[model samples]
Target: MSTERRAPLDRKRVADTALKLLNEVGLEGLTLRAIAKELDVKAPALYWHFKDKQALLDEMATEMYRRMVASAALDPADSWQERMLKANRGLRAALLSYRDGARVYSGSRFTGTDHAREMESNLRLFTASGFTLAQTVRANSTAYSYTIGFVIEEQGVKPLPGERREGYDVQERARLLAEFPLAAAAGAEIFEDYDRHFEEGLALIVAGVESWTRLG
Candidate 1:
């Protein structure tokens, strides 16, 4: 029983509603009925634009990349590490904007033109710095791994579900800290130096790749 009227479906409109649904409900709760309700249309109307939910998601992923924060493309004249790090950080920050945004955005297999252009820029920088196309792709993958891994940690915010969250019991923390001094101390410092740690991880990958330079 398709209740949708005989009107044509615009894929972009469907995509916009899908993104809104993702932001409001997160990926787990996303559904075509929800989007249809939001758009004041029928679920079958959505089918005209997207053959299935997977098609809808693929389109939404591409749209998200285009709508993500605007970072100036990589500087080709910079060193390989410099250009790559800038792109990595920029992409991470863009995806960090929405709730559980990185979780949805990063996992999708997006091969849009915007991503292609960004990679071409990185390859130019790396090739200039003595890497073949294959080497550049390897380094690029490693850089991406560091950034997404870091963002996954940052995005996993497990606070109290409501306004009842005030502060944790310092005495309890202290007792736990006494029992596991090193782990507690490290955990406390994680809050203090997350940014520094992110850079260190990314730099390690970039520097490791640099060691493979063909120079004598």
Candidate 2:
């Protein structure tokens, strides 16, 4: 037999392999066995790293967050509004990067405390800008919820970038709403130009937060 050896299994390697297979098989189709097979190991091998599929998903979301932070050039000098836009935009991009990427991230817990670092920075920014701790938490939570909810629906229509589901055709949607002229006309706004819509919605949220901060 050859003396070559395979790389030892670890949480990051398992999560990374699962993320690759996720794009191919998606969240529903991704299982421990599938990830293990991709890693050239048996299913039981993955169990040592991830107790279950959810555990693997938690790590995957953490990895996605790590990549987002690494790729984003967040500036300390940015205004809270600018920070909100950049952070949410980066989040939306990260969630849209894989098949069911949003789904994979929606409820998964992070396996590490790396997220706390970002949270600390954001809280400090808001507090420095005169927001109370409670206000900072609420503001951050609102924006985070908006980003997650928007991407969940966005991915529902287009599971992956440039790939639309069968029932979400714009013309078909318009036809279905033909009886309601305004609703039919709104189909384009609803389905098309998601990038612009996301930015606009995020801006509205940021504006609201600013107003709330001034009042506080």
Candidate 3:
């Protein structure tokens, strides 16, 4: 840690420090005072850049989203469906990068140039693919919601001891099957192969858009 203080504290610097501290303290423990201590400044100093803690949180969310948008690639050669799959996967990966990242990202307002540009380009791709403007909006919204919601659930599940990727323990699964064979069998589908689950879910959304557009 540098004893020399960074000059001219800014919103980005403050938010960046908050994100770093978030990994250590988690969201509930994060506070303006905590952020100030990380920057080696007094708590009141941050109020110069952010009106309140919520304002700082909003900036933190926006900065995360900006990075998400920046990482997505829109290749013209790829089919619109393929591009969309990449976009959704990329979004999920971004949200999962930090501790409680999805929560921070979903908490903020995405009212900035990066978000606007990404939205415009995605709309153009959908429209160019023969979907009506309304259909495009619905498709995009559904895909975005699904990705974020899935990540929220994904992040919420804690890994159990001796378990890989948050599933029932072998003994627990056997016990569940013996007591509630039918119900457990049905629920098993929801608890396995998360990567495949996400891909198949995204495919259904894309397929629904294609099918609905053709019907119109």
Candidate 4:
């Protein structure tokens, strides 16, 4: 009789497993019990690492942030605007990687001080680019808020890539808005090509920040 010996359980192991299961069950269905079942452990085992679901979510968000940082390809030679674009694009990609990923990351706090490093880097970038510390905070916050809000809406329309919810069909939307010609014609723009739309919006934000900085 052969038996399998599982690896020891830890917070990282639990969080990693939870991220995987997130894609399958989504945030709404994900629970400590579900994660424990997937890890082949009891629910109480998770409590030792995470006192509650919110704690688990915080770890999951931190893991997502870590992966985003690892996969980012920020060029040192690029301007601050370019860096903002790259960073926010990476953030959007990270949030869209898993089902309800944005939801998981939206309000969750990090379990560690890992985010501080990136925060410091961004602050330095803006301050060096002639933005006051206050402006730096506002600019970064605006861009970050835009990215998060965009992904939240994007995910709401399509929970997973290549999968959109009902009632979002362009033609159906057009028909529903038939009485309003302009609104009806806008369906395709609103419902399709999120990538292009995101880029355009990000560019606008960068430009706005530049103008705001110059004015100040």
Candidate 5:
């Protein structure tokens, strides 16, 4: 029997493994020891590539960012509203892909050149859409914050019984609906379809930016 051990590890390899682990175990369950086991290496071996788990997380965030931008290409023909909607939707989808994905990406610092380029491109897109520099910054920040905050709430620690955020607590919603018909009627539509709700919410933000550009 011949045992030649495994190949050497690199940063990308480590980050990739961490992503897989993230998908499998989620943020709370992800750890250096878990990644090491997946790679068939000692925990110390990961240190050669990543100084700590945070470094690995940064790499994972970068990788996620790269994938997001790649998939969210903007065409010159796209209107400002179109671009904004596309970008927000793409970001939400990417974050929802992995378990606790938003937590992972949101925690890491955006210091990479690729991240800078992505940010710059987005800023340019906003400016081209008639927003001032200051407005552009705020608009982008608001949209991003909204997306992250929504996802964090939406992804509530492993699929619950019903699996959707509003849909998850069916009993509570039903009780509320029975107690307050007027409020429940209005809230029911908002909670019924998450995709449509997200789009409508994003549209409201976009409309606010439009009003800002016009009135400012």
Candidate 6:
């Protein structure tokens, strides 16, 4: 935490600190003031880089994904379905790393160079698998949405800062059990199986994409 002649508040550093703050605080608890304090800079300093809280949040979401761009890999030879599914798993893990990180990240469209790599990789995979440019882009979007949606669901288990879990609506179970007998009997035991659920969802998405390859 040296305040020495540091590089000026670039989006990278600002967003980095914001991400750290997010892990420390949470979605609603996150504030520009908190981010400012983390970077040891005044709130006004951040204004030069981000227009407002939403801009700051969006930028942080993109900045945080700098990890996914690094950690995930794409083999050009791999089938499109395989590559896209790999991305989905990588993304879910990355978003789950920070608190409400998914909420901030999901709606953001800022594709910094790193994010672009992810996009290009998915598109390339899809195109290689015999899909058209339009199909490739659509597949990429579908994979992205599914990954983000998975993260949102994962984040639900660990209550965020300043949130009380007392209000979790278990009553919905009765309606769900009316149809899903296994769900009713399992009760909250399902919460213990995030890994299994993740794999199941990933397989479902991949299977759908695989169908495209088979019939395309």
Overall lDDT per candidate, in order of appearance: 0.69, 0.89, 0.78, 0.90, 0.78, 0.74
Task: Summarize candidate 6's per-residue lDDT along 95-162 as a digit string, tens digits.
Answer: 87788878998778674565666567766666765788987776677777877776676677654434
Model 5 scores a TM of: 0.85
**What are the runs in model 5 whose C-alpha is more than 4 Å off?**
1-7, 157-167, 176-192
TM-score for all models, in order of appearance: 0.78, 0.96, 0.84, 0.96, 0.85, 0.81
Better of 3 and 6 by lDDT: 3
Candidate number of the best lDDT: 4
Deviation in angstroms for 186 in model 3? 5.0
Off by over 4 Å in 6: 1-7, 159-183, 186-190, 212-216
The residue pairs found clashing in candidate 1 are none
Specify the poorest-scoring 10-residue window by lDDT in model 4. 70-79
Q: Each model's RMSD to truth, in Å?
A: 4.9, 1.2, 3.3, 1.2, 3.0, 4.1
What tens digits encode model 5's per-residue C-alpha lDDT throughout 1-216? Answer: 879866669877888888888877778899999999999889998888779878889999888888888886667677778877888899989988878888887868753788776668777877877777898888888888988877776677333224553354544666767877776566555445667877888999999988877888
lDDT (C-alpha) at residue 206 in model 1? 74
Q: Rank the candidates by lDDT, best first.
A: 4, 2, 5, 3, 6, 1
Question: Is candidate 3 or 6 superior in TM-score?
Answer: 3
In model 6, pairs of residues that clash are none
**How much is the lDDT of residue 109 in candidate 6?**
63
After superposition, the stretches of candidate 2 with alpha carbons farther than 4 Å from their true spots are none
lDDT for position 57 in model 1: 79
Per-residue CA lDDT of candidate 3, range 1-216, in tens?
A: 759755678888898899889877777889999999999899999999988878888898888877776766567777778877998898887777777777777757753566776778878888888877898888888898898888777666522212344454444675768877776665545665567888989999989878877888
For model 4 the local lDDT of residue 45 reads 92
The model with the greater lDDT, 1 or 5, is: 5
72 in model 2: Cα distance from truth in Å?
A: 1.4
Look at candidate 2 and tell me the lDDT of residue 187. Answer: 84
